[model samples]
Target: MIQYELQQVTQQYNGKTVLNIKKLEIESGKIYGLLGANGAGKTTLFNILSFLEAPASGQVVFAGQSVFFGRTELHKLRRRVVMVDQYPIMFTTTVFKNIEFGLKIRGMTKERRQAVIDEALDMVDLAAYRGASAAELSGGETQRLALARALALSPEVMLCDEPTANVDVENQAVIRALLTRVNLETRCTILFTSHDRLQAAGLADETVVLEKGELVDTSYENIFSCSLESKGKGQKICLLQQKIPFSLPGFVPEAEGRDYRVYLNPDKIKLVQGGQQVQQRRGVLFGTINLMMAEGEKVRLIVNAGVMVTVLLPVDEYAQLRLAIGDAVTLKLKPDAVEWL
Candidate 1:
């Protein structure tokens, strides 16, 4: 079943168009990751999905029913869905009271609320901190507390805006596991926004990319703005951020000197062998490996050359390279790898 369907949704702020999604369908009981950069309308779409703000011009269908922005009984609908912000605001009170507040508003009895609170806290591994001060919890603990509070309501749909953005690495793993547990146990529909593409790919059932308020057909990273400069001889130079230049084959007449978005697919990028001498090639980028993560049978790496670029290699090949975090490596990008977004 489709949990939510958005048709021709467009949101604006101060007379400027911020979000313009034509059609989006969110199915029931699946986790979705909304991937985008800052100001890419991720939060704006979250607001609309949470029904906190209606679109300027569009239709939002919830659970097979058309939602009339102001006419619908939003209070009842809001109870079935919850939005957790990146940095959750906490009440200057005990953790128990913080979770209890929402339950109280819903007219849950004290005994019932306590039971729900205990279950929520246990789910988030915060049962021991029930009496702890909400303001004094660490970043990860606070985020988990917010999740616990949201869980207390048993919302069918949960919208998390940068759920692990502010947390430490340990907490990031904990939150990710907790979300997976919640989805499996309760089968609640989950939608979260993250700037980290790898993190989204690891967690979400489906990943959606939004660029400049429009959906892009990509989930991998390395989206950059580059300008085409004439290099003569039927070739051109694609300057990344007007700095790092990568050679492009036979240029189009219409694209000359024009700034456009290009997506360098991670899998399409080739990594030079460890023992090979670094040579200055047309599509070669020399960079140090800054980050590495295991993604199933593949190893994902972030190379820091002039700009950070993501590269994915097979686990066997990554093991053969014996590369470390600070190891310098060369990257080769084929002309076909540079896709116009």
Candidate 2:
């Protein structure tokens, strides 16, 4: 079922358009990662979805019901949809009380409230901190408390805006695990925004990119904007910062002088030692590793050949290579790896 639908949604500030989405539909019981750079209208879109701000023009449909701005129906819709901000604010009380506050407002019985609060706390691994003061909780604990509060409501839809943005690495992993578990066990529709490409890829069932207040593409992480440098052998090769030149297969630009966007999947690129030679197809570029980090089962490497290129290798392959930061590596780009956007 389609949980939420936006039609011609547009928001403006002082006569200047901020968000202009033609049509977007959020499905039920799925995790969606809203990926974008800063000021990409991500928060504006979330505000409209959460009903915190009315759009300049557009209509939102929830569960097959059309939602109107400034109407009582919106209040009813909000009951099923909850939002957790980037920096969540906690009540000046105990963790149990903070989670119980919403339950009490819904007229839950004393016994039922305690049960639900306990379940939520356990879900976030905060059962031991139930009686602790909310003000004394760390950044991760506070965010987890906010998540527990939202979970206790048993909302049908949850909107998370950078839930782990301000937390440490360990906390980020904890929150990610909690989100995955919640979506799996409760089947709640989760829509979250993150600027981290690897995080979005790991968590979201599907990813959408927003650029300059407009929906760019679903494969946002793989897309690159570049200008064509030259053409040869029926293929157009583009140079990224006059260093890395890769051919664009079956892509003929209308104007050679203009810039174009292309998509290259990170998984398709193979990373090898600097002196290795592999013949047959595609191209190879040597570069020093700028950064390397473990992302789930894969190791994400940022290579600075000319422009920074992202490559992901399985843990087994990465372990065999024994790669590290500042080490030189060669990237093998397959011909079929590059796609026109």
Candidate 3:
């Protein structure tokens, strides 16, 4: 079932268009990672989804019904859909009271509210802090508390904006686990925004990337500012950081000397150690592996060759290469790896 459908959704702020999504469909009971940089219309889209603000132009369909901004019972819809902000606010009260307040507003009986609070706290692993003051909790714990408050209502949809952005590493892991557990156990639909490419790929079942207030048909990794330079014979070189160059067929007209952005899919890249017997190819890039992180069956490697580039490789392939951090490496971009954004 489709949870939310957006058509011709456009939002503007102070006469400047901020978001213009032509069509989007959010499926039910799935985790979607809204990937983008800051001010990529993520919060704007969230405002509309949470029904806090309506789009200037568009049709919003929720739960198989068209939503009319003023005509719809927005307050009621908000109860079924909750948003946890990047910096979650804490009530100047006990953790238990914080979770209890929302339930009380909905007229839940005392007994029912207590049970719900217990479950929500346990889900976020904040049961031990029930009597603790909400304002005194650590950043991560406070974030979990915000989630608990939302969970207490058993919302059908949860919107988390940079949930772990301000948390400690330990809390980040805990919060990630909690989200996965909640989705698996309760089957609630979740949409979260994150600038971390690996985190988004690891957590979300699907990823929606936004660039410059518009949706882009690619993941949000390996994006670089580039300019095209004509290299004779109807070929162009896309220069990154004015150093690394990617040769492309000059099929695009009026591209020379003009600024553009390019996206290199991590999965489409192959990394090899510096001394590997790889041909001096058009797409081969030299860099040093600055970081390597395990992502389930794949390993995400970050290489610094003037510009930071991300590459994804299967665990077996990574093991075969025997690469490590600080090792000089060569990234072989496949023929179709370079994408114009």
lDDT over C-alpha atoms for residue 166 of model 1? 97
TM-score (all chains, Cα) for each model: 0.84, 0.75, 0.83
TM-score: which candidate is best? Answer: 1
Report the candidate with higher lDDT, 1 versus 2: 1
**Of models 1 and 2, which has the larger TM-score?**
1
Ranking by lDDT: 1, 3, 2
TM-score of 3: 0.83
* Per-residue accuracy of model 2 over 218-257 as CA lDDT, tens digit each: 4466566777755556555676544456654444465677
Worst 10 residues of 1 by lDDT: 273-282
Model 1, residue pairs in steric clash:
none
Sorted on TM-score, best first, the list reads 1, 3, 2
- Tell me the tens digit of each residue's lDDT in model 3 across 107-191: 9999999999999999888899999999999888889999999988899999999998899989999989889988998899999
User: Which is the leading candidate under lDDT?
Assistant: 1
Better of 1 and 3 by lDDT: 1
**Residue runs of model 3 more than 4 Å from their true location after superposition:** 225-260, 267-283, 289-301, 313-328, 333-336
Which residue runs of candidate 1 sit more than 4 Å off their true CA positions? 225-245, 249-261, 270-280, 286-306, 312-330
